[model samples]
Target: MNINLKYFKEGLKDGVPIALGYLAVSFSLGIAASNAGLTALQGYLASFLCKASAGEAAGFTAIKEQVPYLEIIIVTFVANCRYLLMSFALSQRLNPKMNIIHRFLLGFYLTDEFFALSISQDGYVNPYKCYGAAIIGSPCWCIGTSLGIIAGNILPAKIVAALSVALYGMFLSVIIPKAKEDRYVFLSIIGAFFMSFILSFTGISSGIRVIIVTVLIASTFAVIKPRSTEDE
Candidate 1:
């Protein structure tokens, strides 16, 4: 088999399971988007542009609450800060011959799952393989979200309302397991709960409050939490 074909086939094989999982998670994102007053087309477009399930879900919620664009910007940056580190790590794995534009475009598919898989490779990563993973994974995410939006529109209003709240539960399911592995994460989770509770009583708009709480808590932990030499 051709070298490029071999690389793509391997990436596609690895990507298939991730794509299937993304379909399920993004489905909820679609429903949440519809509940937030976005049309199916808008929801699909938003996911395409944002390409992030957590940030988009949070942003959609903020948009529903009628926040200013500035708040949305802050929240988005806060939500996506982890990707900053992941991108740097992935860049180190790419060969020197890879074009800058290809590296930039490959970052589009660097979901938590994709990054995990890519970084686990034993040697220099193949750019074409990454592209193949993106090709398979990105579509599953986009199409799943579109289907969710369609389903959200079709369901009864009461049912849709019930389903919308599940997004929070979904977030917790992801966060709680990880939080259990680290003390700082657990403390941050608790801190966020209290901070959010206090913010609830304030006159600040919901979006601004979320943005402020996230930044404050995250920064505080960043400073207090011990950094690993590996990251240095």
Candidate 2:
């Protein structure tokens, strides 16, 4: 697979938004890592190795709690189970003729945003184009994580706390765009907030409560309003 200049340029362009979003989120991760007693270099290494926001967050939390290494591994794996579904979908998009090496390269770059962008494109993906996205996106993810760790080390605790809000803000930004296009998503957001608040007030364990409420509400709605054939 010869990746051309044009493909690389396109990947860089497509990756810009993701890079911007990642900077904030990765910075928060770095801050959390620092607070968890990890060195700046260790934080960067973890981000580079995992390449997953949720998994890294879970790992940090687990580490902070002095959880065993096996438990940390389990938590990280569980947090990233969605990647399995994403990888399965992407496999369907690759050219059937592509070899194992090509698949492996594509898998390396298979982040959530990258998968969404790749699959949303029409027709089968060119291996070079996938390579281009990886070339462009990987650095943003890595560099942001590195800088965030460095910043976390040098900055005051209060400042780090303030900057941490950027992670949630980034999530909101991502969701807002999608919610505008999908009424169901918008409603689901409202339902989630309401359920979370009610559960919190009632003294439920926040994590378990969220899982229970989300499952119950989402399942009930799914059953009551099964997707129409047209919607499907």
Candidate 3:
């Protein structure tokens, strides 16, 4: 197994955005975990395993509601289904000649941010590149989360409250760009809120119900839309 310094450098460079993005997001997760009654260690553990923001949010929501563990797992899995697509995309970029062990190792680090960076490469990813990403990106995620947990404990309540806004701000940052570029995205946002508001009046589980409604509505639209001739 030859270690390529170039690929390592490339992975490190590509992982910079991931590190920065995780910093803000993990900070908010720390705050949320603390508020949700998780200890700092537990919060760090959540960040280490879950990594996905939506999963953590769903888990915390379930915890708050005292939902069954099965429901929590299901919600977290559903929230992260998009990662299946990401993983599929990344598989194409890996070296075909690589062994199963190598592939398995690569798959372990197939995070959205890491996949995005890996696929953006000009050619097939060497094992060293995947190794580099796992080495650098994994630590960034884990360390940032640990730091967030620590900060959550040390920071004053008022300061933590102010910092909590950063997560919403991050969400808005993603939403604004998609809304500006696509009318359908803008409509979906509005539709989601409307459905959620309506569902809130019911006595059933609002969060789970909202997720079901959104998925059903979105999937129905996708099925009804005419496919391009090229796609066919």
Best of the candidates, TM-score:
2
Q: Which is better, 1 or 3, measured by TM-score?
A: 1
TM-score of each: 0.66, 0.67, 0.62
Among residues 3 or more apart in sequence or in different chains, the pairs in candidate 2 whose N, CA or C atoms overlap within 3 Å are none
In candidate 2, position 177 carries an lDDT of 69
- Stretches of candidate 2 exceeding 4 Å from the true structure: 1-5, 153-232
lDDT, residue 147, model 2: 76
- What are the RMSD figures for all models against the true structure? 6.7, 5.1, 6.4
Best by lDDT: 1
* Model 1 misplaced stretches (Cα beyond 4 Å): 153-232
Q: Score candidate 3 by TM-score against the native.
A: 0.62
Deviation (Å) of 186 in candidate 2: 12
Tens digit of per-residue lDDT, candidate 2, span 58-109: 7888888999888987887677766776687688777789899978877877
Q: Give me the runs in candidate 3 sitting further than 4 Å from their true place.
A: 1-3, 153-232
- The local distance difference test score of model 2 is 0.70
